[model samples]
Target: MFWSAEADTSAVLLAQMPVVLPAAANLYSALREPAAREDEDGTHFLFEAGGQTIRIARLAGVPPEIPLAAFVPLDADGFDRMEGIGRLLRALQGRTIPDDHRLTPQQKRRHRHMLQATDGRMNGATYRDIAGVIFGVDRVASEHWKTSALRDATTALVKDGLAMIAGGYRMLLRHRRRS
Candidate 1:
């Protein structure tokens, strides 16, 4: 149902937005049943047919700032050789797709910690108090706690947790490419 003069642009836009064409959804449903790989960038949906390798990458971009569903072709030659490019394109147009916002286990854990820390702060706990609760009172009371590794680590964790809550958590969600 989607129409585009340019294939690459269409692919990128479809991947970036939550709009789903039945075609694209069906394509993803059919494709993701195979084993996928995870890396620093994102999850890669790969398969082979017609003697060519095809790869569809769901890239995780910085959250809040970027859309979570951005998908792209990893293999240019293979993509060009893909048998159903036209069908995929039509599927990417017109309709809306459900958002896949499930967070990873690590992200879920971090989110909980972040929420707890933020709640503590909102309830009148100081940075030192927060550190005490998180790193142990003995460590917080140490002479070097304020200027040492524990303090730095606590600060970093708080900042990262806050950022994730603010928006970064969106990146943790899997895009709507169902297996």
Candidate 2:
């Protein structure tokens, strides 16, 4: 699900952390079906555990076999980096990861609707037609097409979905801050 290295801020950076030889605790044994790749930046590992994907990165010069003590930077993204390290720690310790980080049911439903509406529009469906599918057909029929709130809602959903598809969805990973 994390398609881009720049967008996915959840990676636990091993190179930045303290390296321990003959590690007392290691991530290699605890992760499930870990997939690894090497690039100019580092060695990257992706795995699924505790109902979420865990991403780990080691910088180019770091040894791949060593265990790293989690190190978090005190910056704008400190909280997110801390959270990622916390999840990695829990996984390494054979402890259950908490599910409190997931999105709410309402947010999920709205995102679903946004994608559906965007799909309909891309396939040449009118906003009214999309509204009929999302809202009940009878409800769409009851309102005047020229001055319907559903029309505006359907339009907004498509616009929002398009923005997400255009890479704005990356914002979903970080905590919101007042600007």
Candidate 3:
């Protein structure tokens, strides 16, 4: 694919992005079945918890950048309350993520970079402190350019087994304990 000169690259630029949104909120995926949790109805309950904007669209193969777009100007909490879109988004939240899972070399490096940049702490950082370096921005970023990071990060984490629906089924990241 070729880059568009007039395109809003900053809106989709991952490196220059911020981390403050749910790292795992994304496009349509099957809602989680209750197993590890008690009587969890995943999506249905997630939207009700209410705090983000959510929506759905068809895709043969959506670029990682597209979902990141959702984060900007419309974080999950914005859509989480919408009548039509919220249902679709809530249904698409990913299930549990594992702790021991490894990240892609690039992602691993990014995580390291974040740790270093923040000096391994998030005193003033929003998502960074709360979600750690990787998830901190991913959970709270609803700006245009950062949306893809939110989408891709969440999807990657879930696929690699690093996140989960908390007891309340709000998108909760697999938090790392500080040493």
Candidate 4:
């Protein structure tokens, strides 16, 4: 699930979204892509002007090679997108999604380390160092010094990244590598 920080919105990213490289993404380069659908036959997601795509099957352990039977149309809205996303997932449970292009272990680790480490922690500061390195403009002059800086900073640090939010923050810092 993805949260719209500014919009206070929570939604899951469809498995079939057009992601850059090998990750998942919306086909139209958008999370909420405008697609055609139908409640009767199934849902339809239009990737291109005339290319209407449907969820044939999900690729997980074993990739589903079949294409959707036909284009099923539906309403275009959060509720609709949400419902459609749900149906697609339900129908695709346990399927082997082709995430052949996901990040390498080292790359993901680096990304995590970057998000977890901040400039302050290295100096062994307190409260001001709460945000670690990613946060804290300057330990001495941090605007949040007087406020609940540490608490809020910790939240933001832990809340960094798509999977962090999508996975419901269940994943802990497995390891911290100094970059």
The lDDT values for all models are: 0.49, 0.74, 0.32, 0.36
Most accurate candidate by TM-score: 2
Pick out the ten consecutive residues of candidate 2 with the lowest summed lDDT. Answer: 16-25
Please give the range of 10 consecutive residues that has the lowest summed lDDT in model 3. 8-17
Candidate 3 contains a number of clashing pairs equal to 42
lDDT tens per residue, model 4, 1-179: 21231121112222332333444321322322354333332333332211222223122222122221112233223443343344444334523333212246866765575345433344454534545444444653545455755556454554464345465343231112224
What lDDT score is found at residue 26 in candidate 2?
56
**RMSD in Å for candidate 4, one decimal?**
15.7
lDDT string, candidate 2, 115-176, tens digits = 99999999999999999999989999999988999999999999999998998777777654
The estimated TM-scores of all candidates read: 0.37, 0.83, 0.17, 0.25
Better of 1 and 4 by lDDT: 1
The runs of at least 3 residues in candidate 2 whose Cα sits more than 4 Å from the true structure, single-residue gaps closed, are 1-5, 16-33, 100-102, 176-179
Q: How far is candidate 1 from the true structure (C-alpha RMSD, Å)?
A: 14.9
- After superposing candidate 4 on the true structure, give the runs of residues whose Cα lies further than 4 Å from its correct spot: 1-68, 71-132, 137-151, 156-166, 169-179
The better candidate by TM-score, 2 or 4, is 2
How much does candidate 4 score in TM-score?
Answer: 0.25
- Lowest summed lDDT window (length 10), candidate 1: 1-10
